[model samples]
Target: MISRGNRGNALEALVAGLRGTPTDRADWQAVIALANRTLLTPDLFSSLARAGQIHQLPEDVREYLRFVHDCNRER
Candidate 1:
């Protein structure tokens, strides 16, 4: 869960991750949390996929992103 007093920005984490910057699991967690909160998870996932970066992510993360994107597309 994201702490209220956290100094790290979630959007920054997302952008950094998408930029191919080295990010830890914590950073990806934060980005997913924020994207879910903002209802941007599907879009973010699509961006990664379209950019060919989806294959770079861990299998679990890719699965989660695909699940979220599929859910959104079904709506």
Candidate 2:
């Protein structure tokens, strides 16, 4: 149930997360889920890496994002 309003918040959170802002697990989950649904997981991962903020994320989160990016690449 991805509401339109909530998607906006998730997108903002995604941008904030990409900018190296510290978010809770819930926020990360929301943004990641939204990105997954929208097929933007690779773009999100790319943005973080391109901005050199990938290292700011937790190791597990980075691993997950990388996994998604790799899977998408293989698709």
Candidate 3:
């Protein structure tokens, strides 16, 4: 079982892998896993920003969130 304390490091590793060697299928899988876990954390937005992971966010997910944020701001 993956421990909670380790999630941050795992996320870091996954982000690093995605940035440095995105061609690896395993790295992509890790990215997916991290994104899933991020959904449960309120800090995801800030963590992502601090890590500069927003750019690395999967295109569809990032775009969808951006669209939602834009819509909300216009309301």
Candidate 4:
């Protein structure tokens, strides 16, 4: 399980990556891993969306985020 602290780190890494920061493969992997481990909350989704960061993400990552968002909305 991903601890809250680790999840926060993953979120930060994701945002940084989306912002065009020089993140490595590991950082990107961490974001994907955390996505599988946690649901996308409205606050986080809206934050990314409003910042236009979501559009900056890679296609696969954006798709995964959308999948998570859709799943969360159904719950």
lDDT of 2 by residue, 1-75 (tens): 668877778888786765656355336667889878878778878888887878877788789999999998998
- Global lDDT for candidate 2? 0.77
Better of 1 and 4 by lDDT: 1
Candidate 4 structure quality by residue, lDDT tens digits, 1-75: 667876778888756644445244334556767645554333344556667666766677667667767776788
Give the candidate number with the greatest TM-score.
Answer: 1
- Each model's lDDT: 0.73, 0.77, 0.49, 0.60
TM-score of each: 0.74, 0.72, 0.35, 0.54
lDDT tens digits, residues 21-64, model 1?
52454356777888788887887778888777777777887799
Error of 4 at 38 (Å): 4.8
Query: Compared with the true structure, what per-residue lDDT tens digits does model 3 show for residues 1-75?
Result: 455655655676555543443322333344445755665222333445455666765676556545544554576
lDDT of 1: 0.73
Query: Model 2: residues >4 Å from true position, as ranges?
Result: 1-8, 17-26
Which residue pairs overlap in candidate 1's backbone? Answer: none
lDDT value, residue 62 of candidate 1: 78
* lDDT-better candidate, 1 vs 2: 2
- Candidate RMSDs in order: 2.8, 3.1, 6.8, 5.1
Q: Which ranges in model 1 have alpha carbons more than 4 Å from their true place?
A: 4-9, 17-26
Q: Is candidate 2 or candidate 4 better by TM-score?
A: 2
**What root-mean-square deviation over C-alphas does model 1 reach?**
2.8
